[model samples]
Each structure stands twice: as structure tokens, then as C-alpha cells.
Target chain A: MEEKEIISIWFIIGCLLFLFGVIIFAANVLDYYVPWSGTVTVLHEYRAGIWWGAFLIVIGLVYSIAFNPWKKTKEAA
Target chain B: MLGLIVPQLAMLFTGSNIISLGWVDSAIVILYFIFVLGIGFYLMKFTKTGEDFFMAGRSMTMWIAGLSFVAANLGSLELMGWAAASYQYGILATHWYWIGAVPAMLFLGLIMMPFYYISKTHSVPGYLKLRFGDGASMVSAVSFGFMTVLMSGINMYSMAIVMKVVLGWDIHFSIWVSSITVMLYVVLGGLLSAILNEVLQFMLIWLGALLIPILGMIEAGGWEKMVDRIHQNFPQGDYTHLWSTLGSFQDNPMGIHWTGIVFGLGFCISFAYWTTDFLVVQRVLTAKDLRAAKMAPIIGASFKMFVPLIVILPGLLGLAVIPGLVGETEAIATGGHSYNEVLPLMMARYLGPGLLGLGITALIAGFMSGMAGNVSAFATVWTYDIYRPIHRMFAKTDGTDAHFVKIGRWTTIIGVFVSIGTAYLVQQFASIMDYVQALFSFFVAPLFGTVILGMLWKRATKAGGYYGLLAGTVSSIGMWLWVKMDPTALKIIALSPYAKDMAENMYRALWSWSICVAVTVIVSLMTKAKPDSELDGLVRSCTVLPSEGHLPFYQRPVFFASIVFAVFLALNIIFW
Candidate 1:
């Protein structure tokens, strides 16, 4: 009998983080040019969105790849 | 009148929403909802058996179980309440997390896990059934089942209020959306799904909340400077000192003495909650092996030690950044910021749109997971301890495991609706909410007395256990009513006229616990003890604990617990 594959929770977290990171990072980039009217935080000059977004992207990619069910299935095959 | 104009003034200052989510932020929240449901659906295929539904098939890794254990306790209400407490009472609030929690968590890991694991009980009530018999178990199961659902309802209502206050969402919208989301996932996947999402929520909470402290520290210069700044704000206040101000009730903002801090909180309430609360212990029971089960809470304790950084530090930071935040009553009456708003206000001050959404999503996740934890535990206790036993009582034949699993699914659905009904009840009568919360302390402290005695003392009779529990619960409620009826009664129960509400709670728990132990001892001595043969795996004197000597010293639970304890001590001293 063939072994059934299970989707990893880590992969889901990674994918979600990656998507959120890209959007947040993109928002930061757009705001740099547009100067949006949203409530700018006290430490806006630090660009936390850019740094935090990049951090999430890196973590997300690492986890998504490491725990990817499709990759494990291919290896087993 | 001030009330009439206060509404207009509040709206003027607060604007439409404290936070306005961008498209990106909304997308992230939507994605979170989708992913949780996806995990639940994905796990449904593996959740066919009764064990799978109730215990996650006893297959969780230590990391997953540990994180889930802690995450289940880290409800948004706790996060916000403690943050408010840190502001109101200063760093003394850290005691609740450290000395109050860490020791109890370690005790559960080092001493208690052996019996729980070896006995193969599905719930804490189930453990009682093995040791004391049906009477004690039924009392525990019914109270736990009742309280868990009420707490879930309270959590649901709290989340709705937070959403309304923070983002201007409708209370109905928040309640229905989040409750249904929790219901769908739990009904689909059971404990495994809950554990998975709890781990995810823990991560999200960290990611979402970690920034405030990091950014706050930078803004406040450093810990030393932050302390100095706090001292400058309230020069006479002992805001930064943990143990120094704990000498007397009059000495500290919390109005608590060291004895109360140590004996009342550190020993009684902490042990009762961490060791016996099925909501958290259910997570540990998910561990794959005895070693994993034992190690789970130690890992949880290590993480729990750092929670004050996110929970307490923000309130401390608020003291430095936004002074003059009033109490809840004044905030409502005068259209001012309250201590409870410290976290949200700080988030608004630091996080812009994208990060703001993440923080909101984290809060929502905490609330939803809390609901899931309660409902899932309720389902387990209801099925194994209540429904099954009752079914066995009436029927001649035993039902199949599949029958119980089917019942568990239906119970989850029913539990959510009951919680929803209770949430509406709380909305109608807010004072009932306070009494319902008090119900927890009433049962937990006394029940802990019964369970611990039953586990440790071979002479603890079944009648002794039941009566002790009943007496403790009644005495706790009697004490609560005494304090409620006459405000002066607090002086007698708490042992100090200057003792604050928190201190009264601690001392009440202490008295009730003491009463429970004394009653149990007297009753057990008076009654016939269970035979040694009957005490086998249930009592510590009878049970043979599994040896971990074959494993390396570093891999032992004691090794990690010692390191965690060392860190806990260092933290207390540093903050002291």
C-alpha cells in the first residue's frame, strides 16, 4: 500500500507569512513614494514594515520549503 | 450632562476606528481564516477514532504539545488584562507569570505527568474516576464542563468587545464570525486541529506582539533608562521593583504581601490552574510518549517565562509613554484612555497598517483558540466522563468507539451554541460575568486538593475526596458571597484591611485550599481506605514510574526544568 501524504502546518504558516510579508513589504515601498494619509506610527522613520516583512518572508520560505508535503512525496516516490 | 456630551467628545477624539486596516491587512486576516479552516479540513481524514477526537491520538510532538499548552492559556483577555495590571500595579504583575506559574508548570511536568501519562486517562475528571470513583469524577466533570462552556462564552463576548473598541466592528459581527469560525474548525478536526492552530496562534502572537517591546525599548533608550524614566514619572512609586515592594500590602501598588504572593498565588491558585485545568492538560495528554508528555510542560514553562516581555512590558512602556491613563470607569465616563487600552494604544503608536492588521489578527487568533480549547475540552469531558458513563448506567451493552466519536462531534456543535447563548446572557447582565469567572476559583482550588491527595495518599477514601471537594467549593462560594455582601468581610478573609481585590482573591483561594486539605485528611482518617491492590497505577506509592535513566542527562526533563527555573530566578532578581 502507498503511504498517504499529510500537509504540514508549518508549510501553511510559511505560505501565509510569505504572502503577508510580500504585501506589507510592497505597501512600505509604495508608501515611500506616495506618502499615504494613514496614521503614521511614532517610529515611522525606522521602516519596521520593510524589515519585519523581509524577516517574515525569510522565515516563511525556510519553513514552507523544509516542511513542504509535495517535496516529501516526490522524494518517497 | 457629562454623559451626553462624553459620547460626542469620545467619538470626536477616537474617530471612526482606532485602527484602519488597509487592503493588505484585510487580505492577511482573510488568509488566516482560510488557513485555519484548511488545516481543520485536512486533519479530518485522520480523526476517526475516539482517541483521535479527544486526545489527538496521543501523537503530538513535544514542541507542538508544549506550544499548544501555553497558547491555550494565553487568551487575548489574559494578554490585555495582565498588560492593564502591569500598568496599574507595575512589575509586581510579573509574579503571576513567574513565581505563580513557572513552578506549577514545572511541577506538572516533573512530578504529575508520570501518573497522568501511565494511567492513560482522557481528561482530568477521568483521572479522578480511576482514583476516587464516579462521585468525585462526576462532580469534577460537570463543574468543568459547565465552567469551560461559560468561559468560552465569556471569551467570545470579550473578543467581540475588543473588536468593536479597536476596529469599530459590530459586536454581533465579531461574535458570530469568530464563534462560527472556531465552531467549524473544532467540529471538523477535533483536538489535533485545535493543537495545530494553537501552535500557529502562538507564532502569530509572538510575531505580532514582539515588535512593541523591541520598538519601545529603543524609544525608551534601554531597560535601565526605562526604569529611570518610570521613576521620574512616579518618583515615590515602586513600579520597577518586584520583590522589594512585596513586604506589605501598604507598600506596593498591588496591595499584596509576600506571603500572599508566595503561598496564595504561587502555591494554591497557580497549581490548581496549571496542573488541573483540563483546557491546558489536554494539550500535554496529546504528546506521543511518556517522555514527550513529561517534557511538554517544561518547554511550556520556559516559553511562559518570556510572555511578560510581550504582556507586561507594553504596560510598563505605556507608563513611560502615555501617563494619566485612567481606570475603566473614568475612561467610560470622561472619554479618556484607560489602563485596558494600554496595549491597543501602544499598537496604534508603533504599528502602522500592515503590522496593525497582524496584531489584530493575532488578537483574534488568541480569542478563537481560547474558545476552541474550552469547547474541545468540554467535548472530551462530556463524552468520556459524562455522556459515556451515563450511557453505561442505563444501557446493558457498551457503545462502540465510533458511537462516542459521533457524540463528540454533536457535543462540539452543542457546546458552541450553548456558549453563544451564554455570551448573549453576559451581554444582558455584565455582573453575571464576574460571578461566572469566580466560578473557576471555586472549583479549581478545592478540586486540586482532592486530586493531589488522591494521587499522593493511599488512604484518601472516595467519600473523603467527594466531600472535601464539595466543602471546598461551597466554602469558596460562601467566601465570595461574604465579600460581595459586606465589603468589610475582605479584611477578615484576606487577613489585612489594606489588602486589595487581588490579595483578597489569593487569600480566599488559600483558605479554601487549606479547608479542603484539612477536610480530606479528617474524612480519610475516619473512613475505610481503599486497599493497596485497588490503588495500583492511580497512587504515587503504588505506581512504578518509567525510568529515563537510560536517556542522557541533558535529555531528562529535570535538566531543562532546572535551566528554566534558573532563568526564572534570574529574571525575578533582575526585575527585583
Candidate 2:
């Protein structure tokens, strides 16, 4: 595969991760007001939900990374 | 008259007599000052150029920048202010943290990152100059400098009064202590010492602030008990629900109708602080590269999301336990009670001696750190943007760059005195929050007008930039004055007031910012651009550098954690 194509694929994956994380976060907020008869503990719920959202955002940023031309161009032999 | 004497009489009643006048607290404050001074003195060797003074030589790593960003933004204001809001407004006040600030930080990360990548300049104003022209840049830089000075003054004043109240020292003496400590460090080291001290101060503040809610929860028989207590004492509508007790469109405290709160708090306040404030921008500009700067605000935002757990929750708990503590209204009704004292009062009443002393010390550290951050940023702007320009324009051949650096140090000393003076003058204001917001609104709206338009609009001319800024400033001030003085406007302003003499100041600010943005855009479109030759170096800053492309990917763990945070926010907003 071409380098640009690989970069584009990574970018798309990163975006998907971010969007999914946001949706999960929005769902958690809905849980607070909706009176859902869930058996989940508050501490466990907060930890699991918040940490998961944060994890996805981090993944999104990581996956989107491409080689910077400025530093690399300077280092070329 | 009521404002002046009421506070003094209240101080007489609640003021700490056991702490003694400037003995233990004084020593702690002085030692902390000396430690900061040592950091500043150490950093002086590194202050060799304009970039070093303004942006810490642009060499700060992501972690240090991230931590310091949180520390600087948190300050005593966040500690005291969030707690006070929670004490009065209930969990709804947490909206400022969760909905307002966090999203703004993320938006800044996603959308504004491209600008940071393009504008490699040390100051936001410099970036504006590159994007628009000299006129826009100068107006922004000047207004920002003015706003910084105003805010620093208010912060110093509030900190001094808190120390005076908590430590039983004279207000004048408290001011002197606060001023000297901050000045000693900031004047010497500039941005480097400020960031370093902020990192340390953040730890102290977190430790101090976090203990309050945890201890309060335990004392009130844990979270369930605390909630029960709140439900019992407060009306059914006021207890757990976020929006139930909040002042409606017709009854806001600061003239902010419900819609105003939605826009002003949700958009204007967040945008102005995160996007336009030089102190925040300075941190971003000092990052090692574009990617670090872009990521830094997100980290700060993530931290902001959790801040309510430490700062705001304790205040709500304090409200639940302390009967009749119905927000700042009841607190202020009992003559001489300041909203700033809510957290301190809770500490004194609930916490035991050892922990109480430690907590008070932590609060002091938070206040000083904030003051230090302000002074350091003020010094950098004064030196780089103002004094250096005058020196070059006037002295030319006589003054070398080193001479200007020395002048910068002197300017910091002057800044300290000015801030102290402003603090004393600001005492007559209604509330700390009102005074700070009003001051910021006056300066920030106009500057935001110029910078935002300049960056986004290619047709934005120097003439248009100047006119737009003037129009925005004039209209905002006029609107503010009308709300204050004009009977018709006052009635509109008073629509939100719950009781007589209760002012809701938010309306003026909300309207003012809206007017500013509108005027800037309209005026910029009508004006002619400056010559391309004159705009060359200025616009170059907005051109994305090749180095930006080399940025590395985020770590997998961090990516995963961010996803979790988003889920938490969404669930809380939807269900709670």
C-alpha cells in the first residue's frame, strides 16, 4: 500500500475511535436522568465509563500520527 | 457603605484569633516565597532572549506544560470560586466544569490545533498580526495586557483578604506579603519559574481541596447520608436535580437570563478564557512543538472534568451539613460575609486542628501560585510587547538587548506594585466573581473580536481591525453602563435579581461580547487590507511548519482513557 493510503486508513480509524468514545460518554449522561433500573455500582460505573472514553480519545490521537516532514527533511543524509 | 463596613464587622466575628497575627502562617508564606525566589534566580541564567522570557524558550515538554497548564488555570479562584458556586447553586454549578470548560478545551484541541501549528509565534497577538496585520495584533496585545493587569490586581486583593481573614493579619500586611512573595520570584525568573512553581502549587492545591469533600462526606455519614441531609434541609426541587433550583430566564443573579447562561457560560466564557487569554495562550505557545501545544489543552480539559470531584463537591457537602447555608445569598445576608470564605469557613468548622492548618496552608499556596502565574505572565508581556518596543523606538543605539532584559525585570517590580494597588481599590466591588468577570468582559470581548476575525478572515484589514476593536469596546462599555445606570436597562438587568439590591451582572457581559463579535465581523468586511509587503512576516506565522508533520502518535493507553472520560460525561449529562 502507498504511504498516503496507510496514513488515511489510520486517520479514519482514529476518527472512528473518537466518535465512539463520545457516544459512550453521551450514553452515560443519559443514564443519570433516565432512571434506568441498572444494577451497576456508582464507583464502578464512573471508573469504567470515564476511563473507557479517555482511552478511545488517546487511541484516536495515536492512530492519526504521520511522519512530520520538517524534522525528517532536516535529518536526511 | 454597607459593602465596606459589613465585611469588617464580620471579619471581627469570624476572624481567626488562635492563628495569631502573621506568626506561623507568615513564616510559611515567607519560606514559600523564598523557595520560589530560588527557582527564579536559578532560571535567570536561561533568560537570554525575548523568546526565553516570553515562551520559556519553547522547550517545555508535554508533561510539564500539561501539569502547569492545569495548575495555572486552577489557581485560588477555581478552589474558592467553584466551592462557593457549589455551596450556593448545588450540583448544577458543576456544569461550569463538566459541560462548559471540558468541551471548550476539547474544541480548542481539535479545531484550534491547526492555528497553533501554523502560528509559531510566542504571543497570540503575534499570531493575529501574521494573520491580519500590525493594527489587529497591537490592539489584541494591548487589550490582553490590560486585562491581565486587571485580573492580577483583583486576584491579589482577594488572596490578601483571605489570608488576612484566615491568619488574623491586617489587610495591608497581607497585601504586602502576597505582593512581595509573588514579585520576588516572577520578577527574577519570568515564565520558567512560574511554570515550575505552578507544578508544585497544583499538587498542594489538589491535596488541600480534595481533602475537604472526602472529610465532609465522611463526617456527614458518607455520600448517601450527605444526599439525605441535603434532601431533608433543602426543598424537594433544590436537592439533587441540576436545573430545578437554578434561576430561570427571569430571575438570574447577574442579569443573565436562562438563555444568557446557556450561551455566556457554555460558549462565551469558555471561548474567551481558552482561546483569547494570554496567560493560557502563553502555556500553549511555550510547548516543545505544535502537537504538544494542541494536546496540552485536552489534558487540561480532562483534568477540569475531574475538578468538581475535588473542589465543587465539598462546597455542596458543606451546604448539606451547614443548615441555612443557602448558597452565597445567605452567606452574604449575614453582613460582612464574602463568598470567597465559604471553603475556609467549612474547613474551620469541620476539620480538626492539624488537618485544618494544613488545609489553610494549601489554600494559601493555591492563591500565591495564581498570583505568581499572573505576575510572571504580566512581566513577560510588559517587557516583550510594551517596554521593549518603547526602549527600541526611543533609546535605539543606547540600549542593547541585555539592557532591555534588565528593564523587563524592573517592569515586573512595577507590575507588582500596580497589582497590589488595584487589589486595594477592588475591595468595594459587590463580589469577587462579579468584579473579576466584569473586568474581564470589558477587556476580553474587544480583544477576542479582533483576534478571532483576524485569524479567520483573509479580508480583515488593519483599518477594519482598529475600528472594530474600538466599536466593540465602546458598545460593550456602553451596554455595561446602561445596565448599571439607565433606569430602563437597570429594570431589564434587575429582572433576574431575586431580591432588592441583588445584582445579576451576567447580562451586560453577555450582550457586550455579542455586540463586540458582531461589530468586529461587520467592520472587517468593509475595510481595506494593508499592503502585502507590510503584512509579510506577520502572515507567515499562520503558515503551518514542516515540523508539524513529524508529530508522533498518541499512546494506546491514553487513547483508551480518553474514550472512558467521554462516556462518563455523556452518561452523567444524560442520566443525572
Candidate 3:
């Protein structure tokens, strides 16, 4: 019931998303240089992988960092 | 016509070399649906009151609210609409993303958010009731509730039509399936489920759609090569230049005068929609504090500028990669696609099946996200603004929290059915999304004019508010009919021969906004203004943003606003 616990759950989900993104990024980078016949790469070379990977990591961090409700309080707010 | 198009579309999907969704694609879509349903069902326990159902318990973080804010606008129409716009109007469509949005979003955070947050209002109509009194709230409530449902229906119809055309899915099946799925989450989990799913959809759309422009560049050799190909084939240098085409309506593909694009769209329509439309502002309202509320749009704006990369660039790339689809007529009759189909056609050519499924799912999710936002907002406004007032008046007592929550749920069901009816109505239009946007323009331009006056100038009276909204809506509708009845009226009324159809929506907003402002000011001057004491924290003079001065430099809205504004200017300059 605690908010942080819920945030932690979301943070973990974000981590999983980041993990999937990294795998896709690694595959795209590797497959660009060396072909993998059996591997199915979704959304191949048509993205900014560096930005995309960084975005996923950043979102993971945000879910971890931004979900804290008690870290700072504003009485007027 | 159904018999003809259905078989033809099936063959077109097969023989046109368009990539079809395979088993992996189907699984991706099905899994996403199930995942969202689970999120909805699990969140149901959290919704026990109207506030919880409607405002996500007002506990949303900035990014959650921010992503939902942007994602709400990223509806099926936005993904496909801008693509279609770009396919027809060229890079000029980027103005809608940047000039038409960024500054206005910044304005909402920087100027208007303090009043909204400080007032502690639940919805935009709730704010109106606080500022202008009960009558203004009722007018706003009625119009906003109607607009929300109509917009939702537009999204539903658009999703259905796309599925029917591209995947050969039944229109009724698309409508029923998506509607039931959206209803499950939104009706059960309320705003929390909707916002959370929207965040999920936002990620999917970016991850899936970023492929089109990226792979598209690779297909055309590079970004430079794509530009060269566009110029080589179309030979209109203005196609790539944003400001260049604004010299004259006759000179541009959009046939819209610069005044219309810059002032009418960039100022009037964009400001109204960003600042006032409940569908978008509702997301920002769900944030926990003024800091989160103020930061939401700024955060949304940061991600928003990159949107053209996915939507507009795909349309530009389509010019190079997909040949022989020029006008809508040509696209539909011969190419077996429409200008709106540009996004999908490019995706089909570029993405393999698994990724293709994800891409398609993203588009479908966008529609569902949009529909959920509208239906939920409609439910909230209906329960709080419209039905609550009427029920209170008739019953002579306020209902219990549980009773209101029950009414909210039932209202959501009715709202969805109304949207279904409106969705069917969309089938009758040539450009359904355009009609929807135009209808939105009619409502918002006037609403913004009234809201801005009420917030900034305390002299705006209760009588002034209601009449101004009424006059503005009526004038815009009359102007629209005038132009519709006589095409030459554009030159007569708008004072430019260039305004017609889509371009007319922009200027029509300007005219109605002018009407709202003029009527409200004149009526307020004549009638007695509301006492400033009664207007306490609702007006600009009395209101103060909570986290305005105390926040660290990096966390400040002004800081983010400055960055977004700088980038917006840089983009305009670079594109110029």
C-alpha cells in the first residue's frame, strides 16, 4: 500500500523495459555488421539506437527517481 | 462499394507487396491487449470515489502525467493525420508540431497553471464554475462533454477504418473490440489505468514508429538523399522549407496564408487546445502538486519536439520511397491507399512482420489511448459538471460518494455508446479527422478566449462568460456554414482567397476567438463584474504558483520553457 513500493514495482518494470531495449540495441548493432539468420530484429536500423537506448535507461531512472513523494515537500502546493 | 473495396483491399494487402502481420505480430497485439486489461483490472481496487476514478487519486508523478499529456494528443489521428498532412502539404506540417504546440504548452505551464493548480478545481468546467459561476460552468460543461465524446468517436472510427482498409478487418469488429477493450480499463481503473496505459502506449509508439523515418532514411540512402529525392521528384524547394511556403496561399501546397498558419493556428487554435481543452489539461491536472502540474507540460513539450521525426518525416520519406500517390483521389483510386495511409504503407514496406506487428499495435494503442482519455474525461465531466448538477437540483441533495462513483461508471458506459454512435457518423465524412479537428476549433477557440479573460482580467463577469462562449460557438458555426454554403465566402469573410476547407479551420478559429474576446470584454464592461474577493485565488492577481521561486534552477518550469522556446526558435531558423 505504500507509494514507494508501488514505485519500486514500476521501477522494476522500467528496468525490464531497459533490458529489452538494450538487447534490441545490441542485436541491431551486431546484426548490422554480422547477419543473424534466425534472429528477428524488430524496428531494425530505422531508429536512433544511441538515443533510444539512452531514453530507455533514462525512463528507468525516472521511474526510480521521480516516484518519490516524500523526498521534498511544498506546503503551498 | 463494400463488395468491391473489400476484395480489392485484400488483394492490395497481398499483391501490393505490403507486409502483413504474421503470427508473432498477432501475438504482440494480443499480449498488449491482455497486459492492458490486467493493468485495468488490478487498478480497479484503487478506484473507490469520483476523485480517484477521475483524477488518478491526484497522485501522478510529473513524467507519468507528462507522458500521458503528450500521449493523449498522439491519438490515431495525430500519427496518421500529420503523415497525411505532410504527404499533401509537405514540411509545412511541422509547424503544427513545433510552432503550433511548444510555445503554447510553455504558456500553459508558465502563465495559466498557477491559477488552475491554486484554485484546486477538478476539471476545466470546475475551474469555470469557480471563476464565472454556475451558468458559465453549465455552458462549458455541455460543450466540453459533447466535444469529448465526438472526439473519442472520431478516434474509434479512424482506427476502425484503418484496420478495415489495411488489415481487412471488419469495421464493426474493430469498433466493438477496441471499444470494449478501452471500456474495460477506463471504466474499471479510471484515470489511473488510462494514464498508465497511455505511458505504455507512448513508449510503444516511439519504439515502433521511429522505424519509419530511420529505416526510410536508410532506404533512400540518407537524410540528405531523401531530401534530394523529394526535390528531384517534386521540384518544390518550398516543400522542405517551413517558412518559405508562407509567402502566399497561391504559392504553397497548403494554400494557407501565413497569417492563418502563424496567428490563427499557432496562436489561437494551438493555444486554445493546449491550454484549455479538458482532454489534455485533464492529464496535467492529475499531478500531485503545483510543481508536478507545472512541470508536466514542460516535460511533455521536451518529448513533443521530437514527434516530427516520427510523423512528419515519414510523410516526407513517402515522397521518395513510395511513388505515384499524389492527391487523395489518386491515392485511393489507383494506389489503393489514401494520403492517410502513408504511415502504414511506409511501415509495410520497411518493417518485417514481428516489428510490423509492434508498429501496428502502437498505432492501435494510440487510438485506444486517445479514446480512453476522451471517454474518461467525458465520464468525469458528465458526472461532476452536468449530471451531478442536474441530479442535485432535482433531488435537492448532494449524492453520496459511492452513489456519485456509481453514476460515474454508468455515465462512462453511456458516453462510450454515444461515442460509438458518433463513430458511425464519421463514416459519412470525406476527411473525418479534419471534420473533428474543425469541430474542436469551433469549441476551443471561443472557450480559450473566455477562459483567458476570466483568468487574467478579473473584470470578466459571469454573464459575460456564458454569453461570450455562446456567441463564439455560434459565430464559428455560422462562419463554417457560410464558407460551406459558398466557397467564395472565404475571400469575402476571411479576406483571403486561399482559405478553404482545412485551412479555413485555422482562420475560423481566429474569427470566433475574436468574437469571444470582443463580446466578453464589451459585456463585462457593461454588466457588473464579479467582486475580486469572490474571485480570490482564481484570478491572476491573487494567485501564486507554489513551487515558482523555491525550486532549484534545473527543476524550474521557466528553465525548461526557456530551453523549449530556444529549440523551437532554432528549428524555425534552421528549417527556414
Candidate 4:
């Protein structure tokens, strides 16, 4: 029987975080060009979306690449 | 916390929806659901054997098991409810995270994990059957199965209500969508699927709620300024101190004293829930080896100690920024904010579109993971403990492992339906939700007594274990009834007229646990002792535990646990 390798949860979390960071960071950039309406929370002026998004992207990329199943499989081969 | 009361109470304070998600936010949530279901589908092929289906083939690393162990307990209701509790009771609520959890988790890792790991039992009930006779195991299996199903339902109902109140989503839509999502994933990949999702949920919970404390601190200036502002808002309240206000019932907002906090919550309820409750224990049991199994809960405790940062900080921020939040009935009568709305209100205050979506998704993830944890655990206990025993007794033959695996998968489906049915039942009679939470304590506290005695004392007879569990459960239920019928029973049970409902719970657990220990000891003394030879691998004295002495001191479970315990002590002292 062939040995099966399960994908690491870190990889999944990383992918999602990276994707969300892009979307959020892009949304904030767009908001600068065209101001959005409705309740803009306290400290919105600080642009938390951009910074938090970048933070997620960096951590997410680290986890994703570090635990990627294919990389482990290649190393083993 | 049983993860039901505050949400059930929040059901009363209905008004206009607090926050609406933008298109970007809704997309983030949708993406989360896709990923979880995708993981479940991907893992299906690997889940062939009964062991794979039920215990993830016991191949999980310490980190996976550890995170899942803690995440299973981090339900949306716990997040929202405890955050609300921080607002209602002040910093005293952090006790549930600190003293109430850390010690018990460390004790499990250091003392109890050895017995549980070496015994090779699939469930906690399986361990009981090995040590005590069939009767004790049957009682535990039934009570656990019953409560697990009820808890899943309560989680479903609580999420639905929170969604309706917060985002104007349909109640049935929230319940069905979340339940079906959980059921499909659990049914497809079994415990493996559930554990994976739990790990994912844990990460999402941190990332989602992380912004709250960050933005909250920024808004309030800093920790010191936040404390100063909180004091300015409520001059008489002791909202920042952890232990100082606990000296007298009248001194704290919680109306609880040091004894109740120390003996009742820190010892009795914490030990029972962390050590004996199979929901969390099952996660640890999935560790790949004895070392990993022993280390899992210690890792869990390290992460668990910081949970109050997200849960309690929002509540404190609510006090500083949005004061005048009243109790449930008062909020309903006066059309004001209730304590349960603290987390949602904070999200509304701090989170914008893209971030708002992540916050909402985290809440949904918390709810779904809780349901998955309950449903998966129910399937395991029901198949291994309840159904298989009956099958063997009647048929006089042990079933195939494949048959058991099939039974487990089918039971997962059935359990979800039963939980959904329970959700509607609870919606109709809301008070039933409160009892369901109380009912959990009834089983856990007593079961802890039975399991502790069975593992430590060689002379504890099967009959003694059975009767002690029965007596303790009955006494706990009796105490609950006594208080429900006459509210003044708090004075008798808690030992003070000033003691509140929270204090009553702690003291009741302490009394019930004491009764259980006393009964088990007396009964064991009278009954015939099982020989030492028959108690191998089950009791401490008879069991020759594997030595970790050859391993380096730094790699030992004790070394890590000690560091975690020191941190636990420091946090308590710093917050004191």
C-alpha cells in the first residue's frame, strides 16, 4: 500500500490568511480612492486593515511555505 | 462555563440588529466555510479504518492535539458569554480562564495522562469499564452522550440567536446552515475532520479577535489608561483587581468569596471539566505517542492562559467606552444594551468591512467547531461505549472493526439530527437550556471522583464506583432543584447570604464533589478489593509506568508543565 500524507493545518490556515490579507489590504486601498459610507469605527484613521492584512500575509506565507505538503514530499523523494 | 446561560439570557434582550456585514465581509465568511468543507473532503480517503474514523489513527502530533483540545472548549458562546461575564463580574471572570483551568490541565498532563494513555482505552467510559464494572461505564456513557447532544443543540441555538440579534440573519437559516456544515464534515471524515477544523477554528478565533484588544488599547490609550478610564466610569467598582476583591462576597461585583473561588472553582469544577470530561480528553487521546499525550494538555494550558486577553479585555473595554450596559431583564425593559452585547458592540465599534467579516467568521467558526466537537465525541462514546457493549452482550460475539466504523459514521449523522431536534426543543422551552448546562456539571464532578479513586486506589471496588457516581449525580441534581425551588437555598449551599448564583455553583460543586469522594472511600472500604494482579495498567501502584529518566530534563513533560505553572502563578499574582 502507498503511504498517504495529510496536508498540514498550518498550510490551510496560511493560505486563508494570505488570501484574506490580500482582499482586506486591497479593500482598504480602494477605500482611499473612493470613500465608503456607513459606520466607520474609532481609530479607523489609523488604517488597521492595511497593517493587520500585511501582518497576516507575512505569517501566513511563512506557515504555508514551511508546511506545504508537496515540499515535504519532494524532500523525501 | 457550560456555554449556555448568557446566550439564553441574551435571547431576551432582542432589538434592531447591531451590525451588518458588507459584501467584502460576507465573502470572507463564505471563503471560510469553503475551506473547512474542502479539508473534510480531502481527508475522506485516508479515513478508512475504525481507528482512523474515531481517533485519527492516533497519529496527531502534540501541537495538533493540544490546539484542538483547547479549541474544542472555545465555543462562540464561551467567547461571547465570557466576554459578557467580564463586563458583568469585572476581572473576577478571568478566574475561569486562569485558576479554573490552568491547574487542572497541568494536573491532567502530569498525573492522569499516564494512566489514560497506558490503558489504551478509546473513550473515558472505556477506561471506567476496564477498572470499574459495566454498570459504572454504562452510567457514564449515557450521561455523557445525553449531555453532549444537548450541548450541541444549545450551541446551535445560541449561534442562531446571536446571528439574529447581531446581524439580522434568520434564526432557522443560522441553525441549519451551521449544523449541516458541521454534520457533513464530521460524517465525511469523522474525528480527523473534527480535529482539523478545531485547529483551524482556534487560529481563526485568535486572528479574528486579536484586532479587538489591539484597537481597544489604542482607543483607550493603553492598559494603564484603560484601567484609569474604567475606574473613572465606575468609581466604586473593583473591575481591575483579580484576587483582592475576592476576600469577601460583598467586596466583589461577582458576590463570590476566596473559598468558593479557590476550593470550588479552582479545584473541583476545574479538575472535573479538564481532566474527566471526555470532550477535551478525546483530543489528548489522539496524540501519536505517550510523550505527546502527556505534553498535549500542558501545551493547551499555555495557550488557554492567554484566552482572557481576547474574551475579558473586550468586556473591560466595554465598561470604559460604552458604559451603562444593564442586566438582561433591565435591558429589555428599558431598551438599553445588555452585557452579552459587549463583544458584538465592540466589533461594531472597532471593525470595519473586511475585518468585520473576519470577526463574524470567527464567531461562526467557534460555533461550528463546538458543534463538531460534541457531535464527534457523541459518535465515539455511543459507538464504542453504548452500542458495542449491547451488541456483544446480546449477540455473544465481538463485531468487526469495519462494522464499528460504519456504526460510528452513521451515529455522527444521527447525533447531528438529534442535536438539531434538541435545538428546536430548547428554543420552545428556554429554561431547558439552563438545565442542560447544569446537567453537565452533575455528571462531570461525580465522574471525576469515581475516575480519580479508580485510578489511584487499588482497593476501590466496582460496586463502590457505581454507587458513588450515582449518589453524587443525584445529590448535584438535588442541589440544583433545591436552589431552583427556593432561591434562598443559596445561603445554605454557598454558606453566605451575600453569595450570588455564580458563587452558588462553585460551592455546590465543592459539596457534591466532597460527597462523591466520601461515598466512594466508605463504600470501597466495605466492598471486596480487586487483587493487585487484576489492576495492572489501570491503577497507579500496580501500573509500571514507562520511565522518562533517560530523556533530557528539558524534553520532559514535567519541565514544560512547571514553566507553564510558573506563568500561571505569575499571571494570577500580576493580575491580583
Candidate number of the best lDDT: 4
Show the lowest summed lDDT stretch of 10 residues, model 2 chain B: B1-10
| Ranked candidates (lDDT, high to low) | 4, 1, 3, 2
Off by over 4 Å in 1: A1-4, A71-77, B1-16
Model 2, docking class: incorrect
Model 3 agreement with the true structure over B1-576: per-residue lDDT tens digits: 112122223334433433456665676677678777877887788777777888888888888888899998877667877887788788998988898899899899888988887787889999999988898898889988988888778777767766866677778999999999998898898888888888888877887788778778877898788888988888754578898777787888878878888888899989999999999999999898888898899999888999999999999999877755655445445755656568878877766534666688778888888888888889888889988889999999998988888888888888899888977876655355565656666788999999999999989999899899889999999998898888889986666886656577788888999999999999999999877778888998755445456668987878888988998899899988
Worst 10 residues of 1 chain B by lDDT: B1-10
What TM-score against the true fold does each predicted structure earn?
0.96, 0.76, 0.89, 0.97
DockQ of each: 0.44, 0.02, 0.13, 0.50
Evaluated on CA atoms against the true complex, candidate 3 attains a DockQ of 0.13
Clashing pairs in 1: none
Q: A30, model 3: CA deviation in Å?
A: 15
TM-score for candidate 2, residues paired by index: 0.76
- For residues B493-568, what per-residue lDDT tens digits would candidate 2 score against the true structure? 5454342232333445455566766776677677666655554434433433334334344542235347646764
lDDT of 4 at B145: 96
Root-mean-square deviation of each candidate, in angstroms?
3.4, 11.9, 4.7, 1.8
Error of 1 at B68 (Å): 0.2
Compared with the true structure, what per-residue lDDT tens digits does model 4 show for residues B371-410? 8889999999999999998999998999999999999999
Residue B115 Cα positional deviation in candidate 4, in Å, after optimal superposition: 0.9
User: Chain B TM per candidate, please?
Assistant: 0.97, 0.85, 0.94, 0.98
Better candidate by DockQ, 1 or 4? 4
**DockQ comparison, 1 vs 2, better candidate:** 1
Regarding lDDT, does 3 or 4 come out ahead? 4
Which residue pairs show collisions in model 3? A46-B214, A46-B215
